[model samples]
Target: MKQDSFSGRATQGSFFEGLFVRSLQASGPFAEELRACGYDPHHPKAIYPIEVWNAALEVAWRRCYTGWTREAAYREMGRQLALGFLQTWMGKVVDMGLTMLGPDRLMARIPSLLALDTFRYELKVQPLGPHQYRVSIRNDPDAKPELIAGLLEAGLGRTGVKPTATVVMHREQDFDIDVTW
Candidate 1:
């Protein structure tokens, strides 16, 4: 895959970038590292390099949490991302829809929602039961399953269910996520 194949749309990047900058300004403890990544968070909606996005995330993790592992950072980032999403108008709409539908129904709509996003992969969601689901993504070798798992769990939480997600890698560029509540 090309290095920038996973690059996301500028609007998506802006959402994360804005939150990152605001967090840093609010004493996130990784301002310098994030700045050194060289992508201006203040850029209006425009295509951004995926490398910079991932690098910013790494910098935040390393500089902000001195003793944490990458996995721990990812988990926390995911939680923060979920909360951040709720702060935006679009996010609020999605959150309200998800809450109204509840977790199971929301899981069923995940693939379609992902499709509308700028993620560079094909997504498939399958329901195993009322409280179990399987989500598979293809052609995304660099997929951050931890972040995604956090997002899934957080989304389910909004619907009053405690959810757990287990990710399994299969060959190259394939991820299978098993979710249960």
Candidate 2:
């Protein structure tokens, strides 16, 4: 498995597979299918989200459960889960005067985590209170406000990067962000 792509750090395979497999091990509808199919929950390859697991299972069924044929399925599972992690738990929005950290660096840290080679993003910073400011992200220019909020929540979390004193707004073309450095 690969990790820290930009920095060229290798990550353990167990960490990659553990994300989803751990969920299934907790017990659910998906586990029953895997058991019926004779798949090993303890196997390193079984460590992906239920959705990705289902996709692989479909391909596995078509190929008659051949272990050698699962490589593509596993890769696909990695892509999906990687995207989820990137969009969910990375980046922080700080006050404008906090050491000049900008949008590109923030986006780079995130998209790179997913092994995404290319992506498009836009960020806007506006001054508000005496020591407060707003940093709005229009990730997709065509996306509506609701979508932006969803992205913000995923990329920066509902409470956002500062976490101490911040406001997150989701509105198309006109969103509000409050922050105090």
Candidate 3:
């Protein structure tokens, strides 16, 4: 028999739990937004795919905290959670390439998705050395420095599976990001 690793178990939890905690009501504003974007709310379960959900995870990580200090790291977690939740929804909204609606309308919504408050932030990748990258971010001014860096390290290290990205946050903005992709 094969052994189930801790990382594998955690990933499973992130997805399954994320589905319920991440699902948008089919009868609420979210559903309407989906329809407007070419998604069928009545058949949401069938329309949304696992790949889209996975993509949400990708977007969320990018919005996570980063800083030269620890405080910034902890504060960024909150932003990450909030942004991740919304991206997960939008990813589901257009995951099927707007099959339920016209592609032009779908294309029009692309800017809207990018406009989703959570994704309004920017991320820049700078090569530190050869295989190393330095990720710097500009986020909420009230955020602490130490915690932000720690969180960036933890989040990126886990996401990239190489434990190698260095992150930093600037204490003068509301944007958060991951320097390592």
Question: What Cα-based lDDT does every candidate model obtain?
Answer: 0.67, 0.37, 0.35
TM-score of 2: 0.28
* TM-score (C-alpha) between model 1 and the true structure: 0.80
142 in model 1: Cα distance from truth in Å? Answer: 2.3
- Tell me the deviation in Å of residue 31 in model 3: 20
Better of 1 and 3 by lDDT: 1
Clashes of each: 0, 2, 19
Per-residue lDDT of 26 in model 1: 20
lDDT of 3: 0.35
Where does model 3 exceed 4 Å of error?
Answer: 1-122, 138-160, 164-166, 174-181
lDDT of 2 by residue, 16-110 (tens): 33323431131354454554443344454413333333433453334432463443333333333333433322312232212353433443343
Q: Native-vs-model 1 lDDT?
A: 0.67
lDDT: worst 10-residue window of model 2: 89-98
Rank candidates by lDDT, best first. Answer: 1, 2, 3
Per-residue lDDT of candidate 1, residues 1-181 (tens digit): 1124334432265446435744333233365455456455444234445665677678777766569888777766776777676666667787778778988888988877653245558889988887999999888746777767777777778888889987766557777889999
State TM-scores per candidate.
0.80, 0.28, 0.29
